[model samples]
Structures are given as C-alpha cells and as structure tokens.
Target: MKKIKTVDAIGHILCHDITKIIPGEFKGVAFKKGHIVKKEDIEVLLSLGKDHLYVWEKNEDMVHENDGAIFLKDLTAGENLDFSDIKEGKIDFISNKYGLLKIDVDTLLELNMIDDIMLSTLHNNFIVNKGTKVAGTRVIPLLIDKNKLTEAKNIVGNKKIVNVVEFKPKKVGIVTTGNEVFYKRIVDKFGPVIKEKVEKFGCEVIGQAICKDDTIMIKNAIEDFINQGAELICCTGGMSVDPDDVTPTAIKESGASIITYGSPILPGAMFLLAYKGDIPIMGIPGCAMYNKTTVFDVILPRVLVDEKLTKKDIAMYGHGGLCMNCDICTYPACNFAKV
Candidate 1:
C-alpha cells in the first residue's frame, strides 16, 4: 500500500474504508475498502479534507479485490447459475431456475484451502428456487496475490464448484396398494399425500390406480401407467417384509430394476427405489403419509432432475439420516439428512 494525492488517486483501489459523519443526521461509510477511485470521487474526497489517500500499490504479483472476485465468480458459476455484482469484494451466485443445487465439494475445498481466498455455498443436493442465492465467493484482503487466484482456477479446472440441475416436467403415476384401501375398509390417504409431494416439484399425476396386495395387480398397474406416458411411478404402501407386503416384488416383476429396497433413515427405512427402462419408480412407505419430512423429501428433488441414484448414494444417507421430528418442522433447511 502507498499514499498518493487525492487528485492523482483516481482509478486506484482504496486500501481502507472512508467514513462520512453528520452530527445530527447520519454517519456511515462514504467509501468502502476495495472501492476503485472514480473521477467523480475526487471532489468528494477534497471536500472531506482528504488530500492524500491510502491506495493499493500496483504490483505485478498482486490483484485488486474487485478483479479477484470476478475470477472467483467465473470459476464457481455453472449452468442455471448467475452471479451478483461485486460488493465489498464479494460476489453471490444466484439460481436462474427452480431445481436441485449441486456443489463439487472436493474442488470447493481445494479452492478455499488457497491462502486469502474464500468460497462458501449451501449444502449440495438440495432443492432451490429460482432467484435464490446459493453461494458466495470473495478474497480475504483488499489486495490478494495473483498466484493465489491462479491456484484457485487450477483447482477448479473444468469442474463447476456450484451448479443447479433444472427440474424436468414429468408425468407421474401413483399406485396405492393394500387391501384396506382397495376394499374401502379404510380411506386411502397415501394417494393424496404422494400426489401433493409430486406436485410440489411441478410434476403432474397423469394416472393412478388402487391395487390390492397382489403382485400381479400391482405389476399390471405399473405397466398401464407406463403406457399412459408416466415417466415416474410411485407405489405407496406394501413395502414391509410381511406376507401381505408385495410392492417390491411387483416392481421387480414389472421389469424394473430395483435400486434400493430400504434406506438407513427412520420413517423411510422401508422405502424402495426402482427403474423400469428409463422411467423411475419408488415404493413409498406408510410413514410418509404421516411424517411431514422423510427420505422421500430428500430424494424427490434429485429425482425430478433425472439424477440416477445408486445404492452407494442411498447408503451415504446413514450420516445425518435420522429426523429429529421437531415440533416446528423446517425441512430442506434442517439437518434431516446430508444428501
């Protein structure tokens, strides 16, 4: 840093914040740190009795914070993501569509490890809305070493540190299975519950069927839904190992490859996932009808984006998978799972 005459400081970066105070009216930052001295700023500085200003010295190895922030923004931004203008050497990434937010945790960690550089983002693999701020990046100092920025770029490489996977509009099918519901012995609540959840992702239920605890009946319903252009099918209830529970077997018999039959989560441990050809299918547990949030909520957003889930991916939910069942639930924002 160096001190220069206010008149000559134009186009230089300010090294520290300049305050303006009015005894009765207001007192706030007149010029913030990392602000570039504009032509019009000279008069304001002169009127404030600032003849000399401390500014960042031009150096070959150093980069102004504004430039550093842009570098970080370019490295982190991905499809369906936009960035805000730099403010106080910080830039925020915003989503351009309602979808799932994905972060490259390994690459982000490497970028943050560089000295004087910082990047933070929302948790990976969660739902986000259009215009939502998902991440922020900045430099720790008013001036940072140019080499640090280069190292960050190298760490990022071709990988996007932050991105949003847009949700695809899908025709969904719901298969409400169980003799109680098919026999009308009890009201069928699972269909409505599953429909509400599907609609939240902007998907529509184009076909639905109420089936008894017979594998063949459920298999036929699955085939009928596929014929009706259903891209995703949700089979509710009949997931347990009981003799009456045959949804999982029905899904397999329907030519669908089961991804997982159960998860390491409470209230959703009996959940099942499968795919027939290109269409995804799920066997939702009974708990989903009563619980406000479950593994279904965690995985629905990902499925809407057409993400293929593997058994390993489902197994990872073992960490932070149990729901606290807070009286006042705040899902998608709470630590129900780390997916």
Candidate 2:
C-alpha cells in the first residue's frame, strides 16, 4: 500500500475501509476497500479528519485484511457455525444452532500466538443460542504478511478451533428419595425442581417415583424408571453420609457404573454420578433444592450432550465451583465451574 495526500488520492483505489462516526447516530465503515477515490470524496474525507489515504499496492508476500480475515475464518470455523460477512477487515462466527460451544483452546492459543492474526471466542463449552456470536477473527492491519496467516493455519491444522455440539433430547426420570416426601409428611419439591431444570434443555420427564430412604426401595425405583425407558435418572435427597441417607448406595446397588460420588464444588459436594449401560443416573444432594445453581447445573449440559465425565472432570470443578449466590442469580453466565 502507498500513502498519498487526500487531494492526490483521487482515482486511486482505497486499500482499507475508512470508518465514519456521527456521534450518537452511526459508527461504521463509510468508505470500503477497493473503492476508487473521487474528487468529491476529498471534502467528505476532510470532514472526517482525513489528511492522508492509503492506495492499493499489491505485494505477493502480503495479504489484504479482507482476504486475510476470510482465511482465518476458514481455518477456525467448525460444525454448526456460520460466518458473518466480512466488514472492516473482520468476520464474526455465529452459531447455526442452539447448543454447546466447544473451543479447541490449545489450538486457539497457538493460532493467536501468530503475530497480526487474531481469533477471539467465548468461553469453551458454553451453551449458546442460535445466531449468538461464538467467535470473531481479523487481521491486525490493512495489509499483513501472508506468512503470519499461514503460520496460524498450520497451528490450527486438521482440528477445528470452534464448534457447536447440539443437545440431544432425552427422557428424564425423577426419583425423590426421602421419608418425609414419600409419606406426604412434606410436599415433593425435588421432582418439580428437577423437571424444570431438565425441561429447559428440551428433555421430558417420563417417570417419577417417591421412595423412602430404603436402599432396596431406591434401587427398585431406579430399575423401574429404566424399564420405563428413562434415559436419565435423577435421585434427589438422601445423599449425605447420614445413616438414613441411602440414595448413593441405592444408585450403586442398581448396577450403575459410578463415575464420581463427590464433587469438589460446594453446595453439591455430595453429588453422585453413574451410568447404567447407556443411561445416566445422578444422586443429587439437598443443596440442589435450595441453591439456584450447583454441581447439578455444572454437569447437566455435558450429560445432555452425552459427554462422559471422568473423575478428573469432576475434580477440575474446584477452580470455580463455589457459587456467589448473588441477589439475582445469573448462573451459566457466571463462572460456577470450568465448563
């Protein structure tokens, strides 16, 4: 690119977009790249405080920002994602479906390490709605060394840096295990709570059972739900170490493979996760009934996506597992755990 006086720039093509800001009214590109500069444009440019203009000058080793942004977009965009039209040397990657946003953080970091190349994204494993801006890519300058973008592509090779995993609808079963609720001494609040949480993810509660804290009864309830074709079973209450709290023992006795019995997160440390064949069963503590967000919220989305959780996955929650319990709960948006 070559810089010239605005008056001398007439008839030369602009190498970069010129932004125009009209205080509160507008702020966007007024003159796009490749637009031939005209005599009448000088007065308009001067009003925008432009004394100089950059004219297009091709170089084999350098790439124009618009093309560079497209290259970056092609390298990073993955499944269920769409790219916005390039504007001002940048393009936004939007979600094409409502699902979990997965970011290849290692590769993303490597791509951003390349100078003059940028790829910014939302937190990995975040639940995003369709049309949500998942990521954005751009070149730092109007013209950048082609080698820089090439290096970024090489770093992000083969694997997608950003993608969305759509949630699969499942038949959920609720097992409210506590003597008080089972005998109608107290109303069954856990079932309604679990129902609301699962329904938001597009799942249906196919069956529910109110069982006393008897291990055998709890086991039978879980088996009954499975026989009824429940893909996911939630056992609420009776998760603590108290002798009467046999929900965890019941989950094991039901022949489910236990993944993790305790989480590092507060208000949900007693949580238990297991799977019976392809079915996932969770033993939820009392905190889930009171806390708007807990370990249950931390792991529910992942489960819905059929992402198996390892002990290490649960252990990592220690970093951001404590809930702030703000006056207005903004969960999922807040860092309750590392997604």
Which regions of candidate 2 deviate over 4 angstroms?
Answer: 1-56
Question: What lDDT does each candidate get?
Answer: 0.89, 0.88
Each model's TM-score, in the order given? Answer: 0.95, 0.86
Q: Compose the digit string of candidate 1's lDDT tens values, residues 232-328.
A: 9999989999988999999999999999999998769998999887788998988988999987888888888888899998999999999999999
Candidate 2 backbone collisions, by pair: none
Error of 1 at 111 (Å): 1.4
Best by lDDT: 1
TM-score, candidate 1, is: 0.95
- In model 1, the number of clashes is 0
- Tell me the deviation in Å of residue 161 in model 1: 1.2
Best by TM-score: 1
Candidate 2 global Cα RMSD: 4.3
